[model samples]
Each structure stands twice: as structure tokens, then as C-alpha cells.
Target: MGKPVACLAVAIMILFLYYVIDVISHASGNRYKEGDPIPLYANKVAPFHNPSETYPYFDLPFCSPAHVEEKKEALGVVLNGDLLVVAPLKLDFLVDREPESICRKRLTKEEVARFRKAVLKDYFFTMYYDELPIWGFLGKFDAEGIDDSIVTSVYLFKHIHFEILYNKDRIIDVIIQGDLQNALLDVTDNKEVEVDFSYSVKWIQTDIPYEKRLEKYSQSSSLLHNMEAHWFSIINSCVTVLLLTGFLATILMRVLKNDFVNFTHDEEAVDEQEVSGWKNIHGDVFRYPRCKSLLAAAIGTGTQLFTLSIFIFMLALVGVFYQYNRGSLITALVLIYAFTSGIAGYSSASFYHMLEGKNWARNLIFTGSLFSAPLFLTFFFLNTVALAYNSTAALPSGTVVVIFLIWTLLTTPVLVLGGIAGKNSRPEFQAPCRTTNHPRQIPQLPWYRTTLPQMAMAGFFPFSAIYVELYYIFASVWDHKIYNIYSILFIVFIILLIVTAFITVALTYFQLAAEDHEWWWRSFLCGGSTGLFIYGYCWYYYGATSDMSGFLQTTFFFGYMACICYGLFLMLGAVGFRAALIFVRHIYRSIKCE
Candidate 1:
């Protein structure tokens, strides 16, 4: 049975690795081929009734007539009644050239109605430039050039510039800029107006290479102002790990050596020595924690998250998610989370059984809902805010229903099956030390040695290890930057695990030494507290580094972050508890108690 289980586990891991590698190898690369149509998506359209409320793509008008194409990727939507062309603009630098209009077309009555509705609703237009989105108004243009005429002229400016700044080699940076100017459309008037559309491209070149230009551009974009800070974070983490390793080594070696000397001595001589410390509480060390049901459920959920996270990083390491693949990351996460529901159910049921809990059905139900309930509620709230604002960020009602169905149809059933299997298959909970019928009275600990302080201390090391990387992640999500360095992210993730494990074990030892046998939850909290620090950092980043403003952005930021922090809490907590459990069992087994 053991061999089969081991083999099964190995097979699953191998399969997962193969799938990730296959995806990275064959997935759509981010490079843009010649003549690929650049899609133009509109921002959220504020409702006419309430100007502040917005909904993303719903009820908005496309540049062309509403029609679904068989090949979706081949089409581009119109923005601000202007058809955006994606062809590269070539300039003749030797001689001055005539201005060329890229797109000029008349709007049909239906298209005109759609454009008018969007204008009244105040929808912003967005254009994509090499995976970067630039947002602007449809009828607004820079004040540099303007002319008054009888016919209303709506100018669509396409500014293309190339710069080569260095002497060694000419590396050019290509920039595609889009902006608009509205002359005839008035918000108060309902009359239809004819508008002339014109576009022009301007190219400028310097000696600097494209790479150097990109480096400068990246510096200005986010809080990653310097590479020194990244190096510093890595160095700090390495130092902390080394210190933790030394501390754990010294303590374990000293305690184990003392235990060996005491165990080898005669029983009479051993008893003659002082009857104090961990040995005194051996009888109650393995006693079942109060509210075992809750702990079991937490552990189960944590285990599932742990498994999911490992696979996610593994996928990321192999570059499964590239900048140009829309929704790939989110889609992967949702599917993986749904599939891993069985792991949560199984682990929870097994742990609950070991704790001698009778209500297996309740245990399973709680295990399934533990993370899912809060997640659903948080997402619902964010969706509500988006709906109220009439923003494009709001998920469609159909999508929401589909997600719910996925959870119900796919996740819940698997959880039930796995829970039943685990309940039946789980072995009895056995400890080297016998548990007492009555709970041991935990002694008073020093002020600095209490749960809160220990949690703060234990959480800091792990949080510090990844906080620097966290900055880049936040920038990519919120600041519209491209993050393609999966290899660096994978290394940071591994370091986070090491830091979490070592710090958790250290804190568990301190707690046990203080005669606190209730290490189960404490161990979990010690590692999970890292999420608290992360939240604190988020607050700091928002106030200091980020320039984001407006109710919609704020609502999305904090709302999604709440779920993220909670998930982190679960993952880190489980890691800490597992490490401490192994250490405690090892120490107890090494000692011979009468």
C-alpha cells in the first residue's frame, strides 16, 4: 500500500512537470508578427443615470458593427469611432513627405448611435502598444496643433518616434502613441454630426540604443528605481537564512546531545536529576487540541493551497505565462484551485479523524467552504463595486455564474470523494509520548515571548525575503509594466519557503520551552503572520510609491488584495505547522520517559 501511494505521488509530480514544460515550450510566444491586428478595447462606460457607476464591455459600442468572428484574434475593435491600424509606419528621413491618413471612414446610423451613447456615458478609449495599455479620451488631443474650420475635424494623432542614442551600435526604440481631439460633438445636444478623421505619424531618432532607452523607461515607471535595492533584499534574506540555520543547528545539537546523555544513563540516575522542562509535559505533549475540527479544516485548506502554489511557481518558472497571453495566469490559477479541492477535503478529513472527531460530514463541509466562502464573498463585493461604477473591470454576470458552476460541479464533488477516501484510509493518530486525559496548564511566558511578539518576529524574516520581489509584482499588476523574469521570481519563491520553515521551527521551540503544549495553532500563526506584514507593506506602497487615485482603482486594489493576503495566510501557516510537528515528534521520540 505504501509503495503504491509513493509511486502514485511520484507519477502525479512527473505528470505535472511534463504538462508545465509542454505548455512553456508550445504556448503562444509574446512576439508580435507583421500585420497582426491590434485590438482596441474601451474602458468602462459610466451609466447615464449615475455618471460615477461603470460597467466594462457591456452596452458599449465597437468601432465596427457587432459581429462575432470565427477567428477572434484576427480582429480589432474601433476606439472613439476611429479604426486603429496596426501596420508599422515607415518614414523617409532624407526628404520631407506628405501627411498620410491611416483610416478615414463614415459611420452608419447604428454606429453613430453607439458612439453618441458612449460619449454621453463618458467612456475612455484604450490602445495597446507592445503589451502596454495607454488610456485617453476619444475627443481630446494635445494643444500643440489645432485649426478652426467649417466642418468639425476629429483628429486621431498617431505619433511614431525612433531614437538611437549610443555611438557603439544603433539600437532604436519604437513608440506608437495615440490621442484624439473632438471638435463638433457636444454633450448637451442630441443632433447627429458629421466628423472628419485624420491621422499622422512623427519619427525622431537619437544615438542611444533601444536597450538603454528601455532601462531608463523602466526606472521611471515603478518603485524599482535601482537594482541595488533588489540585490540588497537578496543579500538580507541570505544573511537571515544563515543566522537561522546557525541558531537551529546550535539548539538542536545541544538539546539532542543532552537528551542522549540522559537517555543512556540508568533510569534511577535519570529520575534523580531535576524533573522539569519538556520531559515533565511529555504525558500531555500530544494531547488533542481543542476545536480539532477547525484546525483540521485549516490544515486541509492550507495543504491544498501549498500544493497549488508549488505548481503555480513551477509553471511560472517554465514561462507558461507571457505578457501577450491574455488571462492565462488567472485562468490557470482558477482551474488549478478548482482541481486541488480534493486535496483540501482529504487532508482535512484525515486530520479530523486523527483527532478523533466523529462528525466527518461536517468536517468535509467546513473544509470545502473554509477558503471558498470568504473568496466568493470578497469577489462578489468587488464585482458589485465595479457594477456600481459601470467600469470595464467588472466581471460579466455570465462569467460569475460560470465560476460558481465550476466550483459546484467540479470542485465540490471531488472534495466529497477525496474526503470519504481519506477518512476511511487514515491511520490512527499515534504519538511517542502518551497524552493525558486532563489538559496541561500552560505556564506564564515573558512579555516578549508571547504569541503576538513571537508571531511578529517569526513573520518578519519570511516577509523580508520576498518584499523586494513583491514591489516588482505590485508594479506589474498596478503600474502597467511587463514582468518576464520568471527565473528570478522562482528563486525568490524558494527562498521564501526556506525562510518560512526555519523561522517557524525556531518559534515553535521557544513556545515549547515556555511549557506551551498548544503549539499546533501557534506554529501555524507564526508562519501565517507573514501575510500581516505583507498587508502593512501594501499600505506603505499605496501611500508612498503608487500614484493611483480614484474610487474604482482603490476599490479593486484593496478588495482583491484582501483575498490575496488570506490565501498567503493559509499557505504559510500550513508550512510552519508541518515543520514544527516533525521537529516536536523527533525530539519526543529521542527521549525515554517512564
Candidate 2:
């Protein structure tokens, strides 16, 4: 049985790797011959401020071909607010076309008003062909030759120039440049307004391979500035980690050594050492924390999230998600999270068992739902808002059902298996010192050493280390900016883990020195407080920097931010708790105890 099971697992892993590699290789459009027809897809349009709130391209009074068709998209694309539909225009591979009008429409009063509003709001259009994206603004703001004071005229772009770059038969890049000056229509309140929508196609052969094509899109006008900023942030975080490590190695280690010497001396002198400082409450230091079930569940879920983050970042670093498909990233996230549910189950169940917890079924359920339930509720609320606004972000019923099935089929059974294994294999709770019959009295400390102050201090350092990179990440998510600096991201992630672990261990040592026996949950909160700081930073960014406004943008931003903050809390909290646990055990074990 064991042999068969091991063989099956090995085969399954090989197949999974092959499938992933195949998907990445062909994520872009397939090869095509000369003169073969290439299909164009029109995605949604949205204002600059609220990128998530998207409406269909045909929402405006644009003329369509006789046989317009809707395209079926992947689940990730749909979730990303992309509603791809067949475009009315036709194009042939490697064929150049002269300027030709695809559709002409005489706008009525209402239609002209809508177009004017869209242009004024700075709306942009998105289209895709051969899996390459094209972007263009709907209109240009009027100004007289770089002088904002001189107001000329407001006009909409009526002609689009498409430049397609190809390597052999594969499309390398698609560029859309609107002829705003030459082909434009004046925006007036005239009752009869005629507009001609025209386009031209040009193909350029490039030596760049298909794999290197995405590098062009990954770059931005502020590439130099962003690179400098990223390096500076990385260096800053490295300095911070070095300082913390030095403190831990020199001061913290020296103090703990002294404490161990005094503890042993007193133990030898009195047979039972007169309790004081950390040694006074060694008995109760390892006592099970209150709300053990919740803590266990949180730790379990956090373990899974940590693993998921590392896997995704590594995959991204290897260029798996830069295939010009937004859905591919989201799809990978969902699938990875589902598959890693077993980690959460095992961690939670084993920890709960060590805490002497009962009601195994309840603990298992809580562990499974700890992270997912809140996320579901937030998505539900956001989906309702999207539906009311007629935005493509609203998930369809079928997509919802598919997600449910994935959770039910792929996640649950693995979680059950992990729980069973954890329950059977759990060892007895180990402590360096035995607990007394009665709990020791914790003396009052200075204002700064209190729980709230420690949390504030603990959270600030970690937040400071990552806040600079947070701006870039926020832009990528909320402003449609492409984030391709996975290497920097991975480095910053490692720095965060190092900083969190060392700081928590330092703070835990201080708490124990102050004779605080209730270090279990406090250590977790100390590390977890970074999430609170991050959430507060979100509010600051939204108000001070972000141009986003309106109910839809506000709710969506905060809702998703809340979920992210909560996850960070759990993951960091677990790191802190585990670090402190090891530290406390070492310090206590170093002394002589009855």
C-alpha cells in the first residue's frame, strides 16, 4: 500500500509540473500563417480613478459589425473585470491596411452627452489581439502647446493607428497610438453630430524573441526612479535587519546568560530558588494561552498563507506569471491556496492538541474557515456593489459555483487527511519548567512596556521596513500598473521575516524579564500589530495620494485591504509566537529547575 501510494504521488507531481510548464509556454496566442485572420477582443472601459468599475465597450454609441460575437474567457479574466467580446474590425496576419472607416455613426443629443462625459472623466479603452494588449485614451485635453493657461478646444480621437510587432509568425507586441491631432472631432452641443471611426494597421518584424517580448511592457517612463527607490528601500531594510540582529546577538544573549547564571546560583543555594523577574513565573510561562482554539486556527491558517506566498513569489520570479494574461496570476493564486489547505489543517490540529483542546471537529472547521470566511463576505459585498453599478467585476453565478466546487472537492479532503495525521502524531506539550498550583502575580511595569505600547513599537519597525515597497504594490493593484520586479519583492519578503522574528524574540525577552507570564498571545499580537499599521497606511494613501473617489472605489479599496491586512496579521503573528516560544524554552531550560 505504501509503495503504491508513494509511486502515485511521484507520478502526480511529475504530471503537474508538465502541465504547468505547458500552460506557461502557450499562455500567449498560438502561431498563425501569413494572411490568416486574427481575432480582436474589446474589453471594458473605465474612468481613471476607479479602474475596477468597468463597463462594456459597446456602452457608448459605437457602431458594430453585422455579426458581433461574445468571447468566452477564463475565470481569472472575468474576476479581473475583463469582459472580452469579439471586435467589429477584421485583421489579417502580416497584412498592412490603408486608413479605412470601420463604422460611422451620427450621434443624437444623449449619445453626444455620454461621449463628452466619458472624455472629460479621462476614460481609456483596452483591446486585445493575439493575446497582446493595446491601450489608448478616448480623448486628449485641450492646451496650447505645453501651456496649460491657454485653453483651446476639447476633442475626441476618431482615428486609431495599430502597430503590431512580430517575430516570425507570433505576435510580439501590439501598440495603439491615437491620432489625436490629425483625426479628431470637436465636442459640441450640436443636435446633429457625425463621427467616423477609422483605423490603420502596420506590421513590423523584430529580432526580439517571443519570450523577451514582455520586457517592453514591464518598463515604464519612471523606470529609473522606481529602480532607485526599490534599491534604496532594500538597502534600508537590510540595515534595519543587521541592527536588530546585532542587538539580539550582543545585548540580548549577554543578558540571558547572566540571568541563567544567577538562576542556577540561587537554585544551588536555596534548593528552591526565590522567584524574581522571569524566573519567578517560569511555572506559568508555558501555561496554555487563553482562546487556544482561535490561536491554533490562526497559526494554522497563517502557516498556509506563508507557504502560499513563498511559492507564488518563487513562481513569479521564474517568469511564470508575466505571460500577458492577468487571469493566469489570479488562477495560480486560487489553485495554490486550495492545494495548501492541508498545511493549515495539520498545523492547527497539532497545536490544538498540544494545548489540551477538545472538540476536534470544531477546531478543524475553524481552521478551515478562519481565512476564507471573511474573504468570502468581503467579495460578496463588493460583488453587490459591482452589480448595482453594472461593472464587469461582478461575478457570474456559474463562476461562483465553480469556485465553490473547487473548495469543496480539492480543499476539504486534503484538510481532513492532514487533520487525521496531525491528531495521531501529536506529541505531549513540552515545557522547561513545571507549573505551580497557583498563578504568580505580575507586577506593574513602565508605561512603555505595557501591551499596547509594545504592540505599537513592535509594529512600527516592520511596517517601516516595507512601507516604501507598499506604494509600488498599491499602484500595481489599484492603478493598472504592471509590477514585474519579483526579485526585489522576494528580497524584501525575506527581510520582513528576519525583522519580524528578531524583534518578536527581543520583545518577548523583555516581557519575561518584567515577570510577565502571559507572553503567549502578547507575542503574537506584537508581530501581528504590523498589519494594523499597514491598514492605517492604506487609509493614509487613499486620502492623501490616491485620486480614487466615489462609493464603488472607496468600498472596494477598503474591503480588499481589510482582507489583506487580516492575512498579514495572522502570518506575522504566528512568526512572532513561534520565535518567542523557542526563546522562552531555551532561557528556562538553561537554568536548574525541580
Candidate 3:
């Protein structure tokens, strides 16, 4: 295909995927409700330590002496600290109804089944598998008798129970299960008073254990969910190990390289040295032939996804798409993330290109979609598996098509357009102002030799800004914490992108000051170092934990390592890109005698 057509094809592929996801969600009528049966987060737990009472201390009305006398029974001493971020929630369709449960204005049987399937499919399955799960309701269960329960062509289920987990003013998890055949089963319950969903009631988490297998015993069948989940499990495991090692190894290697020899060239300064803008500083910042920068873009794209995932999770915490309601929100967050890939690719490639870049195609392809594509495929495959196996909550086909369309028509085009704009927007190079026509002696400082360490350290402060939020995000995803924050997480994501690049530039500058004339490799290293710190901190956090057990837990820990590894690589690319841009500006400026 020609360039335009090729671009169109790429856009179509991306849009097709995105459109599918979105369409599936929207076509489902947004049935999943807020909240689910998931556990309350630690921040909430910190306030509920009162032994005799179940309610948190902050709930005291302070209206009467009875309230004042009970004030001593409160759960916590208020204080200020870093506010954490948490994951976004889908819906919870689990559990039978409880007395005093909120009444539904119009509860239908189909809604119940879909919601139940969603609960099992979304929370239990998604909570377990980052990509997709095998046993989720969509992947495994299918209620064949729901079609008979229709009244106005709307197939409502017979039985429905909405389960919710809460902490005072904040509702944590929610589950809504409705039995259709059963609702139609007894003509008695339906012939009566039309009850509403506003049924006033507080729900509680029971010790009723979650069944290990998705479907109940009696009829043996294919374990599609298990098989599918296992496959991804393997993939996730490998990625985790490699990711962990990648960051850790890179950090150690860079440190060693710095200690041993200078990766930067020692082209002795010549009198009247009329060198290309970046020729004076030989480093990764200048330009990588092809695979190098492309590889960098791929890695950076993954890291950007990882960061964005965390951002989605944070939004989950503050209750945007709590549990059952998560599909729409997750879709939205991902759309935004995909659209932003332009920055990662364009930013990286633009600067490197300016430094006299060779191949632009590789750079754009990797940066634009490499990172999101993998996970996107994972999710799509999971949904496909779910559909094939006739899982209840599997995404609808129309939604899938729509999601795919958006990726093509909306995200891809917009990102590319934005990249074009960014490409046209050049950085003012001022190196000519400082470049001397007469040759000068090059300073050699072993410590200041590589941009790797400097750029890596530059990622520190930005990393710090996000560390706490990330912790909460990971906790929510793996630990089954009730998450519902999105807006804050979205903002944080924007901040992270800017921060990562800014810190990278700062570090690149500092290394230049240290007398390291190399910009090519050091720029990449300086920015990529954040991954090392992030992964290291992740491991440290794991070690500090008191509870660590079972294959799932171990797998989660390992998979996180993979995420970190990929994430580090992605960051490295981005940082390099940013640093390269700056370096090119310097060279160009110097050439122009700016």
C-alpha cells in the first residue's frame, strides 16, 4: 500500500480494535452498576479499627451527647499525608439480595443476568487477569433460558440481587444479580407491588467463599476459561521476569559501564572545530540508525501504557466507574491513552530525526501503537474467547466493531495529526551561540561521561510524584481493593508524560555539565533510569509486605516485574526522544550561531 493508504490501514486496524471495545460497552446499555463485592481499600480500613463498632469513627454526627460519648470509639486520628490513587471499577453481579437493599425503579431479568455475568466476568476474571481471564462469566457461563422472560421484548431475568460494599459516605464494591427464569418462575412475586431499585439498605460482606471454579459442579464441560487464562498466565509470567530483569540489569549495567569506561567518544576538540551541532557531544541523544530508536520507541510506548493503566486504576479508586460500572470508564481512559501515543513516538523520533535521523517509519510505527497493541490484542482475544465459550458478560459484537472504528477514525488519525504538528514545532537550538570557531580542548570527567545516570536520576522527582498513586493502583488491581478514581489519575498521567521528559532534559543538561560530551546514549539512559527506580521500589514494596502466598500472588508479583521491565524500556525511549530533541536544538542553534 502507498504511504497514505498504509497509514489508513494502520488507522483502520487500531480503530477497529478500539471501536470494538467501546461498542461492546455502550451497546450493553451500561447495565453494570456502581460498586461491587470487592474489599475496601487500606485507606478506608485505617479508619475502621474500632473493635466494638463496625462503623468508621468519622461518621459521628456530633449532634447530641450520645454521639459525643461515642466519639472515643472512633477508628482513627486524622492527619495529612500523600493522597493515594486507586483503580477504576467495573460492576459486581454477584450475590443474592439482602433485606433493605436499594429498590430498583425498573429491575429486569436480562439486566440481572448480564450484570451477574458481568460481575463474574469483570471483577473475578478481570481482577485476576490484566489481559483477560478464562473463567469470567463471559468466558464460561451462558444462561439459555433468559429469552422466555421478556415482557416488552426486553428480556429481564427472574431473580435479581444488587450487592454492594461500602465505607460510610463512600461505597466501595457493588453486585447486582437478577434471576430471570426464577423471576418468571414464580408468578407470585411478580404479580405484586412494583418495587423500585431505591430500596434503602446497607449491605455487608459475608464469609461465603467464592467458588474456585466459575461454573458450579454437576455437568462436566470444557474449561475454556481455565485454558485461556493459563495461556495468558504463561505469557504474563515471562513478561514479568524479563521486565524485572530488564530494568534491574540495565541499571546495574549502566552503573558498571560508567565505572569502567566512557561510552561517549573522546574526539579531541580541534581549533576552529566546525562540527555538526551534536558532533561535539557523542551520545545516544544524537541519532540511532534504525532498530535502536525503534526499539526505544517500542519500550517507551509500553511504559506509557503501564503509566496510563495506573492512571485508570487511580480513577477507579475515587469511584468514577466503581466495579460494575467500570467498562465505560476503562474504555474512555484507554482511548485517551492511545491518542497520546503520538507524543511518545513523535517526541522521540522528532528529536532523533532532527539529529539527522535515518528511518522515520520504524520510529512512528513502534511509538504510535506497539505498546497498546499487545495488551489490546490480549483483551480482544480474551473477549473473543469469552464469546466463543458463550460467557454471559462477553463484549457484544457491535461494540467491538465500534471500538475498532474509533481507533481508526479517531485515535490513530488524531495522534498522527498531533505528531505532525509536534514535528513541525521545532525546538530553538542555541548551540551556535556557545560553539567556538577556534578549537578548544575537550574536558574528560569519568563520572560525567554517560548521560544514562544523569537522565535516569532526572526521572526521580517525577517518579516520586507518581509512586504513591501507583502503589495504590497496583494494590487495587491485584489485591481486589474497591477502586473508583479516574479524573485524578488522568491528570496524573498527563503530568507523568511531561514530567518524564522534563526530568530527562534536566538530567541530560546536568550530565553535559559534568563534561560528558556524549548525548546519544546518555540521553536515553538518563530518562530510562526511572524504570529501574520504579521496578526496584515495586520489589521493595513487595518485600515489605506481610502477606505473600499462593500461585496467583506469586504470579502477580512476577507479572508486575514484566510490566516494570517493559515500562522502563518505554520510558527510556521517551526520555531519549526528549533528550534528543533538546540536543538537536542545541546543534541546530549552534550551526545557526544562535
Candidate 4:
């Protein structure tokens, strides 16, 4: 039974590997690959004769200088080029009877009402560049709740359209913000419809000359020849080096050698040695030292990983990936990840106080170091390079100083109080009852010995963004299509949640196998390893895109993302693993004793 279960697990793992390899391999042939050209619209552009005329082919209006319709305000300012301010200060789309007339022929009255009905019912579809969607459905079905009043509301309504902001010089990610009233009819007098949406960034693809061959293999309908390939070179990836991993005897032997030993070895039931590695401050974590250290570590790592996962998904969902500029997002993600550390600190402090960690100063210092110290060199090197190149935002020195200040002044106190509250709280961890009949030390279940199943589960959450973004990016790159997948970042929220759950489950199983009943740290570590793959992929991307120069390439590649994601993922992995570990331990401890 043990052998067969192991075999099944091996088979499953192989299939998963194949799936990932296929994605990356075919990724180059993506629908909208960097260098690919955009396809021409079926109907070429003709000069618009009438100001209010409707075109025959496309639905939108012709490009116009200025013609305000009746629509309510939705978003912020719209910039013309890379510049920050170029505005009506607050400019958006003003909804009219039908969209602005670009084509010579006008839409039939029915079509005119249809446009208003669509807007009133479905609202608008937003597009952003680096976005993380945490809520709302992808705009698929027509929206609901449209009454005649909505369209007729005050005779004019408008929604602000702006690319969620992205400074090639500054690593920025915009979250999805959508809120518009549903149910509107009457399009006779363009009324002002109120909108309630939020901010972020947006994206667009330029068309390059089209080749018939491209159409044969492409999924994207739009193709232009004036394309730029980012990081997607064939020579740079270690992707081809992978071998069929059906687990040879030696492979199993190696795994067993390491894990089996760890499993069988008996550990001291109680932690006897001094709890000295990372000290909690003023007993900030809890009153006790060792327990506080463990909890703090757990919190810091878990929160960090969870947040990182959210961002990755958000970007992927939007089909926005620049291979030549891989590192740019990394750096920004790192800074964003700082927030996770703060949350972790707070969680740790709360758990520590519950466990009774004694030293307050130790809690703060150790928790801070658990995060800052480990990755300091990597971030420092990145920042130094960024400043040297005169590329991207240097995260104002004031920001760094401010961060530390916040940690000590604001974070520390919040954590301490939360810790105290935790001390007075009750355990919420609950585990499924152990129900093995005639329980065997060596069970023969296919999934019994390995944590692969759990790890696979974690993949789905992260993959959700990948699922949406991958299809779009693939279409745009390899196929040459256009999709509004990146409008909002919140779309990734649910996927992130799914991923966190998977990590927690897998970590629990790994800990159980290790028999390190003090399985918290390892649990977190196991789940946190996914971030390593992210960095690996980014590095691979950097070497792939050929058009970028060494300097522009480097700046574009690692400028915004590389530094940020690396730091962020590290912290993210730590937090995710910790969360899973602690949750498992809590549940494990509560199981009915034999």
C-alpha cells in the first residue's frame, strides 16, 4: 500500500510538472508575444465626416478633441504621455445617446438605446497595467440593475477613464476600484449618471504590421509589427533542462534518507534548552521567551507570503508581464511586502503575549530582524544599483527612515496591545478527528507519505491570476489578441485566499511527517518555498528578451519589480508558512488525546 501510494503521488507530480512546462514552453508563442505585430481591424480607419456619426465595424466612437456628454464622474485624471498632470484635473467619459460618432453612418435608434442599456446595465470595463483585483467578477456577462431612471438621471452621466498609473521610473501597482449604479434606461436626453469606482493603472497594445503566418497560429486577433520583446529569450531559460521526474529509486532514497530520519528521531517532549535565538521586546510577543519567538516568526512569515501571492495573481490576471523589465515589479513588491511584516509583527506579538513571552524589547528586535536582517544585503545591493543607474524611484531615504520609525512607534505598540489581548483570548484552531481504523504506522494510502497533494493545492490560488492573465498574455504575445484582463487588481483576491489555504494544508502534512511536534517553523518554510520559483522565473525572463540594451534592459528588467518581489516573496513565504504551521499546531494540540 505504501509503495502504491508513493507511486500514485509520483504520477500526479509528473502530470503537474508537465502542465507547468507546457505553459512556459508555449508562453513564447503567447498570443501577444513582445515582438509580434498587432492585426489590423477588419475595417480600416476612414476620416469621420459627421461629428455624431457611428461607424459600421467597431462599437466605440472616433477619436475626438472635446465633446462632453452627460455622464457622472468615475476615476481620476488622464495623462497624455508619461507626464503626471495633463488634465481637466478630473476627466472621464461623458455618456451620450450613443458613443461619439467616428463612422459615417449613425446607429439605428434601437442600437442607440442598446448602447445606453449596456452601460446602464453592465457599467464600464476598466483596464490597468499592474493591477491586483481583490473583488468583483471579470466583466463577462452584461451587468444587472438598469432602470430608465439611471440613463435619464439628470440627463448626463460620465465615468473617468485613465490608465491605472505606472511610471516606468516608479514601481507602482493599482488595485481594482469599480462602483457604478446598475439599472438605467431612457437615452433621449443624455443625463449625468453617478459613478463610484476607485484607482490604479491601465495598459494598451500597439499594432505592428501583420503577417498571414501569424494568423495561422495566433489566438489574438489584433497584431502589429511595431512590437517590442521584453524578457523572453530561448537561451536564457533553464526551462529545457528539466527531466522526466517519475522518481528514480535514488530520488526516493534521497528523500527518504532526509525526511525519514527526521521523522523517526525522537525530540525532547519539552523545549529544555534556552530560548535564545530571537529575543522578543519587553515581552512584546508574550511574556514567555521561546513561545513568543516561535509565534512572532510564524506571523511575520505567514502574512508576508500571503500578500505577495495576491500581487502576483493580480498582475497575471491582467496579462501584464514585461520580461525585459522583470526586476522592476520585484522592487516595488518588496516595499509593499513591508506591510506584511508589520502585520506579522502584530500577529506575533498577540500570539506571544498569549504564550507569555517575557521581554518586550526582545520581541520587537527579533521580529524585526526575522524579517529585515535575513534579506538586508539583497535589498541593499538592489537599492544601491537602482540609485547608481539613476533608474526608477529610490524609495526616498525618508521613506526608509519613516518605515523604521513606524515600526517602532506605531507597529510596536499595536503589536504589544494585540499580544495582551491574545493572552486573554481562546484557541480557535480545530482539526478533523483522526479516524484510521486499526491505525497503522505505515499506511498504504496513495497520498499518505508525501505533502505533494497539499503543495499542488496551493498552486491553484496563485494560478487563478495565472489562469486569467496567462490566457490574455499568451494571446497577446504568442497569438496577438487584445483582452481587458488587467483592468482591476482585486480580481486576484479570491485566488490568493485559495492559495493560502493550500499552503496551510500542505505545511500541516509536512510537519506531521517530520514529527517535530514543534512543527511550526518548518511548516512555514515548506509553504514559503513557492516564492523561490517566482524569482527563478523572473531571472529566466531577464535573459530572454533580446531587444533591450544592457543598461535599459537591466533598468527595465530589474528596475521596478525584481527587488520588490524578491524581498516581498521572501517575507510572503515566511508569513504563509507560519500561518499554516501555527494553524496546524493549534489544531494538532486540540485533537482528543488517546
Top candidate by TM-score: 2
Which regions of candidate 3 are displaced past 4 Å?
A: 1-319, 322-324, 338-358, 373-456, 459-466, 483-506, 546-553, 564-594
**Cα lDDT computed for each candidate against the true fold:** 0.64, 0.82, 0.43, 0.37
Q: What's the TM for model 2?
A: 0.93
Mark the 10 consecutive residues where model 1 has the least summed lDDT: 74-83
Judging by lDDT, tell me the better candidate of 2 and 4.
2
Q: What is the lDDT of residue 101 in candidate 3?
A: 26
- Sorted by lDDT (best first), the order is 2, 1, 3, 4
The TM-scores of all predictions, comma-separated, are 0.75, 0.93, 0.43, 0.38
The parts of candidate 1 lying over 4 Å away from their true place are 1-125, 128-175, 179-195, 200-225, 259-266, 270-273
Candidate 4 residue lDDT tens string, 273-382 = 42221110111211122354655655644554555456555455443332212233443344344434445445555555544565745765676666455455545565
Model 3, 1-594: lDDT tens digits are 124334533654564455446544533332223444432111111111111111221221111122222111111111111111121222233333343322234435443443333322222211221111112111123233577332222222323333454333233344444432324222112232232322122366444322212122211222222445534543454444346435654664475345223323343443335443233443333323345655546544644555456544544454344333324454545465655555454454554455455566566666666655655665565455444543322345555676678777776775565445435555433233344343334465566344444644566755665665565566554443433345545655555555566555545455544444445455555556667777767676666742454333344355545555555656555545555555556533433222
Model 2, C-alpha of 131: deviation from truth (Å): 0.7
lDDT of 1 by residue, 1-594 (tens): 133234435644775676577565543323333334334333334433232244443244333334432212211111111222333233322222234443344545565656655553334544444334434443322223345322232332222222212222222343433433332333223344444433343435477643344455445444455567776776777777778778877987797678667665675665535766667788777888878888888889999998888877777766566433455566667777777777887788888998889999999888998888998897788777766765545565656677779899978987887687678776687688887788879898789988899999988888877887898888777665667667777787778777888888877876776678888888889988998898888888778987665676676677767778888898889888888888888888887755
Better of 2 and 3 by lDDT: 2
Using lDDT, give the best candidate's number: 2
